[model samples]
Target: MMIPLAPATIAAPFARYSHGVEVPAGWRLAVCSGQLGMASDGTVPESPREQADCCFANIAAILAEAQMTLTDIVRINAYVTDRAHMQGYMDSRDAHVGTPPPASTLMIVSGFTRPEFKVEIEVIAAAP
Candidate 1:
């Protein structure tokens, strides 16, 4: 099984995420490309929360193809267009991730390929 690490010496994580994750030997790993907040139908939602949800949904579909689920995720890297979108993204992330949530990083970026895109997410998952 994967291990979640949060050393006592270090400050606790700011949110629902582990400081780091230790993937065991002989496990299969899948790394997904950053997914934008666009739907399969090419629709982009105006709300940041809705867009974040779409990003997670896309990630889920990708993980499913590798016979893995979000629970197997070990790390997550997310980007938002502005600080205002942080909470929305965090809310969706908290809802989607499994227990002992994966190590995570969130950043505020200038923009994305499309102006309407508010969030982008990528993940690394490992399973035995």
Candidate 2:
């Protein structure tokens, strides 16, 4: 269930992601740190698309560790090293998210910890 918070005066939709409205007083919350596109061997994926996929995969892994699924996600923040791959990343995210896209933010950044890593993701999920 979507918890209503005090409305913000900002018009920018992306702000909804960066400054997520406060959850209801008693609602349970989950805070996940950003997930990078590193592999088991510490190797970063070569392409933006591949890195994006891995980044989401890692986020899913985090949620799973907490006994949750993507459906539990209420908000997400995505960082991409290449803006040119926005469409491709959107396609992949759409395919992976199923339906009713969660509130999200995608941004292009100058770099990540690893040179080959092209994307990173952070997620916020809630449960009653």
Listed per model in order, the count of residue pairs whose N, CA or C atoms clash below 3 Å is 0, 0
lDDT of 1 by residue, 21-50 (tens): 999989999999999999999999998899
- Candidate 2 per-residue C-alpha lDDT over 1-128 given as tens digits, one digit per residue, 9 for 90 to 100: 55433356856453323234334456676778988877657777677677667777877888787787776677878888787867656665666662345678889999887677677788887766
Flag regions of model 2 displaced more than 4 Å.
3-26
Task: Indicate which candidate wins on lDDT.
Answer: 1
Q: How far is candidate 1 from the true structure (C-alpha RMSD, Å)?
A: 0.6
For model 1, the superposed segments whose C-alpha errors exceed 4 Å read: none
Candidate 2: give the clashing pairs: none
Score candidate 2 by TM-score against the native. 0.74
Per-residue error at 102 for model 1, in Å?
Answer: 0.2
Worst 10 residues of 1 by lDDT: 1-10
- TM-scores for all candidates: the values are 0.98, 0.74
